[model samples]
Target: MTQPDRDPGLQPERTRLAWRRTTLSATVAAILAAKTALHGGASAAGLVACAACCVLWLGFLLVAHRRIRDLAVPGRPTALAPRWATGAVLCTVAIALCAAALVV
Candidate 1:
């Protein structure tokens, strides 16, 4: 009886790249939201929504950056914690909602 060797392959690299892409998307969304808020009449509520978008972007960035860093380390990376995952999801959804608020 013999155990098969595990093939790490490029999965980790792919995951890291995916996270980078997501981070980029979040950055773009935040930037667009700010631009809209500034040029689209700058209402008090719009400004507040823009600020919230920035905060949510930063939060998501922190979560993504930590995951990317973990993926870069050799050996098996630890599973993402439930809290971090939840935070990332919430931040993303909230960012979209805030952006939509600015638009409407």
Candidate 2:
């Protein structure tokens, strides 16, 4: 027997779940950054920047999750997370710099 056509809504649901997973990973990364700064004897400037990046990254995650939930509803168009991606890139850079500070 032939399978029935899949609903378009499934696309958004899958995308939403992917976003949630990404956000969760980001939160964990932020935590790791903080721990590295605290225990690695990172320089003051580096530690501060890493900590700030963690806070900002969390904010991005929160906003992305909220937007995904809102988009899951039938009436709303999907909201793309441009800001979150940008924040993630910046946070990665900050974390890298902090790690470097620990070694050098």
Candidate 3:
């Protein structure tokens, strides 16, 4: 089979997949953090941290959406998204801390 010529343009599917992965990570992190904070012997300080993480998680999604939209226009130049996967990562860290503070 002959291969088709590929443009250097951004792959839309790749962008969608990246977004899906980010969203899923955020959701999983949120669920885990909330659960651990609520049931895993979370301290007042730990709970506050978890809440902050949840906020970060939401922020990540918003940033990701904005980035995707910006990248959608082929000829439009835009600033790159921040390197930090803030929300999902923050949530994960918060859950880990909560689990440690409470369970471990």
Candidate 4:
């Protein structure tokens, strides 16, 4: 059996997978950090941090899905650059949560 010719232009699929993996890792990190902070006696702060992290993760998930869909279909009239703001937000939240966890 002969394999079909792979379209090299669809290379964004690799990036899509990477985005998914990052989202998953961030989620796990958030859960662990929130749990630790709560256990360390920063109940209120920890809960808030956890909620914020959850929201951020959801945002990332939605963006990742949209990006993957966009990548799947090429040649659209308007080309959009990936939103770096989302990534910056994720990093900021993660850092804040980590600090909150440590202080707790």
Candidate 5:
């Protein structure tokens, strides 16, 4: 038995674009977090939160970049692994929390 040809259509392209948009959003969030942290007198806690935000942003970027690269491959891309998905979600949530902390 043989598998039938699958029409990839624009799905891969769309997914890749979505990831790019997400990366851009994350970048903006990180910048805002830093700005908020600095707008107030740079307290030790604020600086620490800012640093955490940057680290989380980097983590997300790594995950998004890998997924985008995988989508660009010629053949059918593999499904996202559970571990990577979890990591991405955790990073996103952590970034949001850090940003909120900086604002508050």
Candidate 6:
């Protein structure tokens, strides 16, 4: 028997799911870091950093959601190019998480 062909949008759907997972991970990590910071020596600074990380994650979530919505279109896009803000904030969040861990 012949194998069934995959849907054209299957890749995009998987990509969208991956983005959602990334956003979720960022949110959880931010919350944990915030909690760690709150109990650290500098409560004020830790809380402030936590708030900033949450805000940045929120921004990336919104941008990723919007970009994924356009993934279903039949345009002839060659490669995946994430928006600058999304990529920058995602990297920033990773670095901030490390810094928060050290400080906490």
In order, the Cα lDDT scores of the candidates are 0.84, 0.67, 0.65, 0.64, 0.86, 0.65
Q: What are the per-residue Cα lDDT tens digits for candidate 3 across 1-104?
A: 53344335546647656877978877787677677667757778768867865776677677677767766665544556445455545645755665576455
Can you tell me which runs of candidate 4 are displaced by over 4 Å?
1-6, 40-42, 74-104
Candidate 6, superposed: residue stretches over 4 Å from native: 1-9, 40-42, 74-78, 85-98, 101-104
Model 6 vs. true fold: TM: 0.65
Residue lDDT tens for model 4, 44-95: 7677766766666676677666767776664431244646545646665765
Could you list the CA RMSD of all candidates, in the order they appear? 4.1, 4.8, 5.3, 4.0, 4.0, 4.7
Writing each residue's lDDT as its tens digit, candidate 5 over 1-104 gives 54344444768888889999999999998898888887859989988988998899999999999999998886688898999889889998998888767656
Off by over 4 Å in 3: 1-10, 40-43, 76-104
Ranking by TM-score: 5, 1, 6, 4, 2, 3
Clashing pairs in 5: none
The candidate that wins on TM-score is: 5
lDDT order of candidates, best first? 5, 1, 2, 6, 3, 4
lDDT tens readout by residue for model 2, 26-63: 77866776776677577787578676766767666666
Candidate 1 residue lDDT tens string, 30-57 = 8988898788577798788878888889
* TM-score for each of the candidates: 0.82, 0.61, 0.58, 0.63, 0.85, 0.65
Query: Least accurate stretch of 10 residues (summed lDDT) in model 3?
Result: 1-10
The runs of at least 3 residues in candidate 5 whose Cα sits more than 4 Å from the true structure, single-residue gaps closed, are 1-8
lDDT of 6 by residue, 1-104 (tens): 63345456577677768878877887787677667766647666766776676676677677777667766555432345656555746656564765556475
Instruction: Give the RMSD in angstroms, all C-alphas superposed, for model 6.
Output: 4.7
Mark the 10 consecutive residues where model 6 has the least summed lDDT: 73-82
Off by over 4 Å in 1: 1-8
How many clashes (backbone N, Cα, C below 3 Å) per candidate?
0, 0, 1, 0, 0, 0
Candidate 3 residue pairs in backbone clash: 57-87
